[model samples]
Target chain A: MTTDVLIIGSGGAGLSAALSAKEQGADVIVACKSLPNNAQTCMAQGGINASFDINEIDTHISDTLRSSHGLGSEQMTRTMCENSAIAIEWLASIGVPFSLDEKDNLAKRFMGGASQKRTYYAQDYTGLKILHTLYDNCLKNGVIFKNERLLLNLIVQDKTVQGATFLDITTGEIEAIYAKSVVIATGGYSTVYHGFTTNGIGSTGDGIASIIRAGGVASDLEFVQFHPTALKKSSILVSEAARGEGGYLVNSEGERFVNELAPRDEVARAITREINNGKGVFLDLRHLRREKLTELLPQEMKLCRLHEGIDMATELIPIKPAAHYTMGGIEVNDSLETRDIKGCFAVGECSNAHVHGANRLGGNSLLEIIALGRMAGINASKFEPKTTAKNQEQLLKDKHFISGVYNFTNQINFYEKREFLGKILYHNAGVIRNEIGLKGVLAAVRQMQKEFTFMGISDKSKDNNTNLVEFIEFGNTLEVVEMLLVGALHRTESRGAHYREDFNSENETFRSHSMFWKEDGVLCASFEEAK
Target chain B: MIKIKRFDRKKEPNSVTMEYPITEGLNLLALFYKLKSTLDPSLSFTGVCRSGVCGSCSVMVNGKPTLACSYTPKSGDLIEPLDYHPVKRDLIVDKTKALHTLNQAQTWIHKTNNIPRDTQNLHRIERQSNCILCSSCFASCPVMAVNSDFLGPFALTRALRYTTDSLELQPLDTLTAIQQNGVWDCTLCGECTAVCPQGIDPKMDIMNMRSKSVQNGFDDPTLANMSFGFDFTQGF
Candidate 1:
């Protein structure tokens, strides 16, 4: 079906865009890979960042810039900081139930590397509440949702993206959705760490990959931020609010290693160093007031109980740094539209709009979505009506893609390969990286990609075929992994999240964003000053 | 061994019951993943955030609705698709139709420019907002056996959430929408509350909604029908 705008995800970014575009009198359809509530946005436990004080916008911008470490553009950071209060206001209007402070104003809490209490929260389920609130508002405004449709390819004609091809999982139908504009908000690539990440099963960076393949530039892919505290066994995140609320990081010898309120990259590396030293890292929340801890960080308390089998409020919680957020995504202009493709925009974790550099600020992701998602939606809706007729041959080809997956001779199972990729990447290039480790990771990934040619799925059923869908996602992951390794290999400096053990320190010469794109279907990367 | 009920609409002999030796994992989802990736490649189930919060990997274990990612599994356990929704495969049920109630009931805040001074009001309705929409309540509710039109637990809870929200303006569409198939229809069996991993008592939320409905001038429709109970007038 044709629409004025077709959103490729239903997370906060896509839903925010949908609400904005619909309000602007544009027909909008949000194609969801999972249900709207199931998007990775719901998994965000930390509260969103917004400056309530009048002069604090400048401070918020500087905090974000400082977090970015050099690569974030001042103008892009300003757009987000300026719109922070407006976003918080809209959220409160839609019943976000942000916690309150002593004077009965919106409560703000400390996040790592922040100058003041600036994050607005709802207990600990901040992202889920915000996402549900935004979704409810979208429904109230009559935004259309098409669920369980995996984005396969964007339909581009003469260098303009006008629509996309979606694999409707329910009926095994290749549905072509035509629109004047499309927004890709399909989240990040942290799922490349698989068993060692806080991302969802669908957080595969497919949207970013599709945009890059469609001739859009992707920026700073190597700078994947490792969250300092995830449950060691399950990798479920323990929010930074724990440290913000006086929790401590204690090594096996009960010695405090680093400042708990350090920025994510610093804290993550410290914890990893502890782990590498044959000592276990633990988050000692036992020192905090039990009642206040339970009241303020309910999700963390519950997660520790369920996943780690311990009462974190009274005990030390074991932890390891896990791949959390990817700083890399489609490069967009001030308008939030892709530099190469008109009528195409990116938002949230999928778009690298120069708001983030190497490591992201703790609460900026939630703020970035509203600021950029609304802007992208408005711009996309204003694009003149255009049509790139559904590529019939490609449609038919993709329609048969699943069946081909089923028919392929069962040789090397890529599921095991996918798992292997995660572990190797985590050990070699996770919190710390160097030339030797990166080269080993690159060789392993290439070998896996070659073996993936013989990929096959035993699940032959046409309906709800997750096996086939995941295999395709694995291919998308392999492409991005290669790009990440190449980008990491070229950058010879320890800067922010992309720390190289060999280089060991940040250098002025390497203070540019890492850019990745495709030339004739081959992935390419370079360190260049972000434009 | 774990017993699983499998069905595929597009395949012949659509229903099958099979047992497989259990795989080692910390939770039921990990075991299911092991089953899918190694032993039996055709096994199908849905999981996203392999944590209880996302609400995607819920299924029936021994006739009880459970989130696979959170619940620990035991030997000889019987795994099946959720009770009410159409089974797409082994353990995945279509939640699309089940989730349509949110749209139908307009379970959203009737937002206004006037924001509340503080978040004190949130404590009252905090449980209602915790729903992850796993549809476990819908699957476990006895009411779905009789009426598919019932708005179900999550939607009703959301209706109550917005209708009673302090920031919401008067004349909420959620209140009116829940009158017919939304609030009054739930039997208040508490089965939804039992299976809820988030500890949200949807039954209490429904009861609160019923009271709010009375305040909003929505009469209990069941009182007019008058057919339930032991019927002492039967001429023995």
Candidate 2:
């Protein structure tokens, strides 16, 4: 299929980008790996950040920068903060049911790192509501949606990305999709934590891996935000909204350990420290009235009750910190165009425009998706169409290379290796990190990569072969994990989410973005100081 | 042990029942994942987030349409794909036709240049928009079994959401859109309401939409013909 713009995800960013591109008189198509509504955006229970009052834009920007520990780009931060109200208006224009205040205006609430109550919400299902609204708008605008098509490789010639090859999970066919511009919004790699992640199974960093395999660059991959209130054992998120709404995080001693409204890094570290000290952590919403709990935090209440059989209004919900958001991704400029790839753009969690820097604020993700995604779409639409035919031969060769690997003689168990990789990552690269642990993880990952190359898919059938998909996704996970470890090892300073116990605090020498690239089949890492 | 109804397009008979030992706290989706990873690498099912947020893992557990990610498995639970759609593989049904019903009903807010005021007092509208489109309600809907074109719960609920929005410019058009295979087609059997994971009462939404439709001067064809004077007997 050919289109003026091809979006690689169906979440908030991709859908928003499609809407913007279509409005720009460009034909758009969204290719998603799962159902349209199944992206990480749907799982965003908190609200979106936007200074609706306009006067508070400066405050919002400062709050974001402060939370990011001075690593965020000033230009990107200002763009997001200034355009937030317009993004909220665009959302409301498309009929997002934002919760209203007593005066019937868009309801604003306090998130952890925001100075003002500028986060617009629709109860607790804010992300889901916004996503559905955008998706509905896309349909109305005649944007084509192709689901269950997993992106395999980017078709790049010279320095421009002309098209992509996708493995149709439904038919098991490798097909080429050519486009004038390609937007990669495939979300984050927090699923590298595997069992202890708030991300969906599909958050394997596919776009980043494919781009890297095609010789693209990524930045700041070591900084992964660990949300403070995931349900213990299940890892389902208990939204930060619960805390913003006067809920408390208490230790086993029934004492409030830390300020619940602090930035995520502080709150998460507090919880982890408590748990490590033999003190259990719990989210106490029992003080809130049952009706209020049902009304304000419905999703969180429902997930806890359904998954853990714990009613929030009646009992203390067990809680822990889990891998939640990825602040590092494909390196993009202010317009969301990738640094190395000419015709390719990145948005949402998959692109590090450096707005989040080392730590993300509570509701800025949705804001980034709408504002940055729109910018990427508008900018990508203006790019002239390049010759895309030359990429077809390369795509075919890449397809054979991917499919041919299924027949390799394998001695390693795929599931065991994946679990091992997950453990290594979560233990070493999780909330706290150090040089020794990171180096250990790097060695373990290298050993796993050897086995990953020879891993075999038992089910070779072409149609909806999930085993094959898992195999491919595992490989992507391993590649991204290695980058994360190498980046973590190189940056010895403690900053935001990348807390290295060996190096206790932020150092002036390492105050820069960590960049990762591939050369001669070897992973390389370097730091680029903030420009 | 849990018994799952597995099907593969390439296999003979195309279906078989397999049993596997279940861990105590494992949900059905987790069990399916375990089976796919260890016992049979070909086993396929749809799931993401494993949380109830994303509705991709809807399946019939013991003939009840429930979210596999939320519902824990029993020793003898019989899992099957959702009905009212063609099964693509084991426990995976084609949800395209069912989801397309929303587009058919034009369940989207019309574009407008006017900035919306009066954003408050949208409690009802916000409640109806909580739908996740998980298709569990549609899977359990009895009315859909009889009429394939029936605008299922989520779609009708969405229509109600838009029609009730004070900012909606074409309120009458929104009401008219749900006149066929829509509000009137619903049996209001409460099956959809019972199966909804999000606690959205599509049955109640349908009833409310019917009232809104009547207010908009659109009535059910059967009810439109009824008179105040009732006959004592059918023979009369």
Off by over 4 Å in 2: A52-54, A241-262, A274-302, A309-317, A388-390, B113-121, B217-219, B224-236
| Model 1 Cα lDDT, one tens digit per residue, A153-272 | 887777788788888887777888888899899989999898889887888889987887678788788889888899998898887778877889999999999988766788888899
Candidate 2 per-residue lDDT over residues B134-204, each given as its tens digit: 89888898887689888898899889888778667887766787899889988779999898988899999
The regions of model 1 sitting more than 4 angstroms off are A52-54, A244-256, A284-298, A311-316, A385-390, A400-403, B23-25, B111-120, B225-236
Candidate 1 lDDT over B1-236, as tens digits, reads 87888987666798888997875546788788888888887788988898777889999999999999887778889999999898877888888778888888888866563858455676777778877888888888999999988889988888877777777786457788778777888888999999888898899999988888888777888776787665757954
Model 1 deviation from native, Cα RMSD in Å: 3.1
- In model 2 chain A, the worst 10-residue window by lDDT is A385-394
Clashing pairs in 2: A104-B120
For model 2, residues A1-531, the per-residue Cα lDDT tens digits are: 788899999999999999999999999989999889998898887789988555699889888998888789999999998889899998888888888877777888777767688888887789989999888888788999999999898988888988889889899888888899999999999988887788888899999998888889999999999988898877888877798789999999999999998877889888888987899999999989799999888778878877777889999999888899999999998778888889899999999999999899888999999999898889878777557554678667867966786776656768777777777787678888888889998998898787775677888788888888888888898889999998998888999899988997999888799998889889888999986
